[model samples]
Target: MIRSHSKLATALMGGLAAGLLLTACGGSAEPSSTTAASSAASTAAEVATSAAAEPITLRFIWWGNDTRNALTQQVIDLYKTTHPNITIETETADFATYWQKLSTQVAGGDAPDIIQMDEKYLAEYASQGALLDLESIGLDTSDWAEGTVDAGRFDGTLYAATFGVNAPVFLANTSVFEKAGVEIPDDTTWTWESFAEMAKQIQAAGGGEYYGVENLIGVDGASKIWLRQQGAQQFTSDGIGFTAADIQPWFEYWKQLMDEGGTAPATATIENQTTAVDQAFLGTNRVAIGFQWSNQVNAVQNASGQDILILRPPTQTGNAADGHLWYKSSMYLSAGAKTKYPEAVKEFIEFLINDPDCGAILGTERGVPTNLKVREAVAPQLDAANTKVIEFMDSIADELGTGGSVPLPGGGQSETIQRRATDAVLLGDLDPATAAEQFVTELKAEMGLS
Candidate 1:
């Protein structure tokens, strides 16, 4: 029941970022000119200076859009200015292709010095001994979200360090709700049945102008939340956590939503699921409610042009704790365990994560940072969209729970399996029970579980 850092952030926010950054960057307070402390500081600085001046070239690979790729390069260039002799070659790929390419490189024993890891596949790589033990190498997690750093651990060893934390939340369009003449549900005490009734009512209010809810069938977050509420999960340490019996009700519930006119049509719903957040049905104002990671509130809000209500998902019971809401790592940076330049790679990572200059240069493209000082330091410089995200995450601090874990290796492919089964159910090619069986069967096949 260990929780990720949330309210802990408020506790640490009192300290100013300047002094924290100074300390992280090795800047010492003024000491007596003749004191032993002064000499020690000078010796440390000289050693650091010597290391910075040594010629070291490291490669970093990540997947992102052009903006992220560009920002990352900007951070790399900034690092060069500080460490004049360090050279970092960069590689970038889109989300879909990055894992396959990284897998190929890893299998060939040609992995880059540093990698950008997603929670889904992190365990696979870390378990394969592909990522460096970040804890063993002295990367600081002092300012990060409590217990949540375990998101990057494999068998209790930290292999990666998260940039920040995000949660799965229901994004409700206030404008749509007002227009539909329906009050948003009391998410703190709402049940799944209440959620269904609310969606149906909203659709009835709209009279075909828009949908009440985005189709939840194929959306992975919805399934994860539902599974959690049932005391199950999408994945566990060994394999897929829920069986056909456990998941059939989920498919049936959403299928009921569709039959009752609470969701978009199957084709359009499937298409919406595949598109970017800003272009999804919810973002385009076609759905009154949607599910997304908390970090995506900015994108959806900007697209719909509203400060949407960020609500926790309804649970099996009316209690908020029954919702099993939890914080998830947005993403992480890991080093290759077999890296030749381990010290240089660690230094570069420390700079990107802990340095004030890096926090400013990288901005929040990687989601709001988990570091308390970095979050505070860069808060003022961010736009309203990102600022609102920070505020919303803080507001839900107490509701955040635990039990989120990465899929087991090939279990990362659960999204594809779930999508296929959902399409079958929605398109009438398979019944809910049948689709549920197929979903579990395929997932087990993917994970190579008996």
Candidate 2:
């Protein structure tokens, strides 16, 4: 939900092209004699020159801000040096307006050759036949990070190639915990009760700032994690999973926290937001804790200008071990289904994932690295903030649960369901039970399910 397109599309695409071309040509050449080799070299040089003379242009579109845009252009420049024959036409927009532009492009049948996609819209776009099967383009998941790779899969096939990894994590300001005299437990062993108790203690600490957590009843916030913990996914295996009733308890939990004064006041929670960390209770030091993805540690830390440490999501006590929240692609790269140069696009994706120099240039702007080799390559260059993220995520690697569940199905108005759930909780128009019932009803109606 937080838009973090680093404008590294050109670098990703360029590296992909060069890597693929090199892969194709370098693997099977034969040795030649000196006299014959001289003539052969001459002929090969001529062909290379001709290929270089005709530039291959790839149109790439993504979302980000000015810093990201400038970084992207620099990457493009680096990529062009290695791939002299390839020229990339860059298109970018802020996160708010990206979908509008992409939708128009899709409608006009002029979508860019390479597209950066999100999970919410992936099924819709892929089912519309707007995206190419990444597997068809020779990009396989055998080497990609499992969670990120899974996020790109739709139905049974992969429609996009992931750019990086994102896992839901909490950022705790240790200063708040110390001031409150509340001990921060190791995330792996902390349960819901322990978390609630900690919140209560933080509230008891004398300060204008309240206790432990901030409320996040909105979609892409607490609700998603709640659904996962209940062993009821947001959308079904076929994409019509749970309804409003399924999401009500998640809202109730926050209401309970608010009533206890273990979190920011209800008024502030309502005003605060999940997308904007600066608008979060924790950001204003109104609360000690906030729920968000690991990559957001920097944003929250920067907003609060305080030291922050990553914590795992609180575990459900009696629920079937659903594990921590699901990890997903920060974003994905897909080839336009209608691209005139499909092979080239495919090659571009492969490069983005595997090319060391490109991955180093792109860094972890998308989140953390999804490519094993690239992760290693870029590890040394990560800043203290990003390095902390990488280490925290990796520390919990063995404990992270599986999200091998099928991709959400298509033709079911899934996004509408998510929005409605968020609205009901934040607006307080409906209690948990009513919301759950309404959600189920709407879901069944949308899918025409029994």
Candidate 3:
């Protein structure tokens, strides 16, 4: 199974801490007006002297929506109540803009003290000596969710802490399925061929204007799962793990789906990805099935104004374990290598990961907290969509896949290569076999391989 931890530990990873102190007057009774005034002044002076340290200002940065932003600000405010000597400044942006701005900041040596990281750039920044070693700096991971402690490490060195946890999910729009009069297949026994056939059925109902799904050809993460199911990997620590033959069938699988009218036309297939998420086929409710991260069900619902059902991805052997789905970090938290206040950063990471109050305030806005205790603490407050997401995760607890997925140095370019080659094949400019070969060759070049 993908989850190395026991089912109880895997689904729940039980987990979250903070103490604020208030000064109390030492006197037994109220004193005279003059005496009171003198004592008050003395107490203030004493407090100031005791807390004496250069006032620390930490710049914390992340990418998220209004909900996440509000909850994050609340958490920051709560932390400051007990920390008069520390001040935290915050910066937030959408996903694309956040990466671009962060890249520029890092390049110029002005990166924020605490940075929210994505898997795509974790390697890029950590490899360049931009991220701090969380363990060496003394950030505790004992209470974190199972299988998550090492998620942010590279080369056996810790570099990041998980922010939230999610996994790859096959999403089906129930509203669309109802409209087409097609029954949602049983996810437990579904195979890739049957999944494609279901998509084709939906397309027949749409009469060519709408497709049943997006082409799997250009989805890098799902593509990784496909390779993993076959006991190969899309990436390795040093280089690509699969040869052209291993992935050639994958390209052909998508070609057959597209040929059978299961997906959008090749041009629309590629163009839809570059558009805003809500404007895409899945979000717009043009498709019945597609792939999405587990936590993204809410966004898809908001865009489509329809209910979405999260399904285990179809597998080659009609077994959930064969799907090779694993729990993945939604994002990560890392301190800048040059952070002036390492101790303060450690305290902040501790509170964020271990405090129950923080969990209650933040809810599932950042995805489910990796600490199982936090998930339970925040469960009552999550809305219907988020509740569904939680339940779905629990149902598939025992089927999680493990290992075989380790992003290499240049693996960020995997998406670029996949898109280009997929476009060529989907547009009929190249056959599936030719596109697969080119995909491998181009990826090799990008990663500096021979």
The candidate that wins on lDDT is: 3
Please give the RMSD to the true structure for each candidate, in Å. 18.6, 16.7, 19.2
Candidate 2 clash pair list: 16-351, 236-241, 244-435, 244-436, 244-439, 245-436
The ten-residue window of minimal lDDT in model 3 covers 15-24
Alpha-carbon TM-score of each model against the true structure: 0.82, 0.78, 0.85
Q: Please write out the lDDT profile of model 2 over residues 1-450, one tens digit for every residue.
A: 223444476678889999999998886444421111123322333333226456577788887644456556667666666766666677877665688889899999998999988776787788788998877767755667766776777877888788888778777888787788877777776777777778877887846556567666553545667677766766655655455666677767766766676666655555565235555577756676777777667667777888888887788863324454666677888889999888778767777777777777776667787888789888998788889989977877766554434334332354456446545655566676776676667667675566
Q: Write the per-residue lDDT of candidate 3 for residues 1-450, one digit (tens) a residue.
A: 545557656445432011111123333444321211123322333344226666777788888765567678778767766676677777778777788889899999998999999877778888899999999988888778887878888888889898888888888988889988899999999999899889989999988656888787888878888888888877777778898888888888988888878998778888987755566888988889888888778778888999889998889999876777888888889999999999999999888887889877776566678888778887888788888888878877788777754476677778888889888888889888888899999999987898
Whole-model Cα lDDT per candidate?
0.80, 0.69, 0.81
Candidate 2: residue 109 lDDT (0-100): 90
Candidate 1 per-residue lDDT, tens place, 246-357, comes to 8899999988899888888788888887876666788878889999887777667778986588888888779886767777888889999889988888898888888877
Model 1 shows how many backbone clashes? 0
